[model samples]
Target: MGRPAIEVQGLWTQFGNQVVHKDLTLAVQRGEILGIVGGSGSGKTTLLRELIGLQPPSRGRVCILGEDIQRLSAAEQRRLSQRWGVLFQQGALFSALSVFDNIAFPLRELRTLDEASIRDLVMLKLRMVGLRPADALKMPAELSGGMVKRVGLARALALDAELLFLDEPTSGLDPVAANAFDELIGHVRDGLGLTVVMITHDLDSLATVCDRVAVLADQRFIAVAPLAEVVQLAHPFIRDFFHGERGDRVLRAAAQPASSPGGA
Candidate 1:
């Protein structure tokens, strides 16, 4: 908590008369994985969009690395963008570009690296995400949903960003695939010492990866401690979400005392 890597103070966003976010404030520490969760239409994505400069907050301040992004000059903002990376929710890959080009896109646009160096860098990023060098030459359409997401992740790392934002990285994948993707995220963050801010509905991720979780509720974010504590919350939506219809049986078993040799 030594001066948050990302800070938001009194943030607000609106769509005409509709208020998406209000009086929102949050601080994310460097190298920490922070998870955001909320019901649909809760402005979770809106908050991320505002934080990353995709959309301006209707009011308030967003500071990253001690600089207010909204106040920065165009060139200054572009320069700051180089230090952060984003993976959109749906694996927003360029349909026409090959995976190699997609992964190299950020580096080529932001840096003055030569073609040879860019290729080397792209290949390294692809391999880091478990994709083979040969796979880099293939187009996005040729890859499966899971592979496409991994390629998007590789692209996010191309800029050598200190902060990474992933929007539903595990969505639409099978359970096993999603679990593998989660492990990859943890591994990548550890290997790169990256600070991750993710928006996810997956409780498993909260338990397995996130350092802290913030729930969007009543137009503000409230930090929930451990995954179990989050599960025990009294909010109707929170309880229904974490303890789905079938989850009650599991919870009861989990709460029950251990069996003894001569149970009464």
Candidate 2:
């Protein structure tokens, strides 16, 4: 296994009188796809935000790529920010920008590439996400939900980040599209050697792309292990989650051996 790409120690988060996480500790290995799962309000998103420095833990340390993000100098933070990309739950594209320009936004903001190079890169990203060159001319309002997600993914990968953060990457898609999207994630993970941290309610995603699963419960993670083992955990939530009807079905499908398994 590679060195830890993300490390959190003694994490705590609170809002008003509500405590979300308490004393959570975790380490995500490099090049691994880790699924963050829990019941509706288990602090899954909170933890993601904290790890990415969007929200500060009331008490804890978050270190990414060996630098404590909270402690980094402004210049260091800027450089670190370039190392990863995030796909929000909703496709948060700028309505004013065309699809191609949205994909190019990061490159324009972060690098010195000229318009020609940027256009070439944007085209490549569009193709990488299985989007047509023609789709680039469409507005965000003109795309389907799945296309919107793909565009968001293309934009996230625009800068060639080493790490990718996805919030419910498959939510709101039909089963077939969701399945294809899962494979796409794995495709990019291997092709780009990217470490992926995804927060999802999709059990099949955990089975399909996640190398490990982290279950958040009781204000912290109950376990972080391979899906097979995580399902067998003795916690009530874990039992109810994985042994439930839908979960059991998806997990069974996931444990099946693939003849050519190449996608995420």
TM-score of each: 0.91, 0.94
Model 1 per-residue lDDT at 71: 99
Cα lDDT of all candidates, in order? Answer: 0.83, 0.87
lDDT of 2 at 220: 89
Q: Which segments of model 1 are wrong by more than 4 Å?
A: 246-264
Off by over 4 Å in 2: 257-264
User: Which residue pairs show backbone clashes in model 1?
Assistant: none
TM-score of model 2 (CA atoms): 0.94
Instruction: Write the residue-wise lDDT of candidate 1 on 1-264 in tens digits.
Output: 466789999999888999888899888888778889999999988888887888899999999978899999988988988899899988999999999999998888866999999999999999999999999889999999889999999999998888899999898988788888988988888888888899999766766677767888878875545454566778877776768865665345434442111101
lDDT of 2 by residue, 150-260 (tens): 999999999998889999999999989898999899888888888889999988888877888899999988999788778877899987878887886866866765322
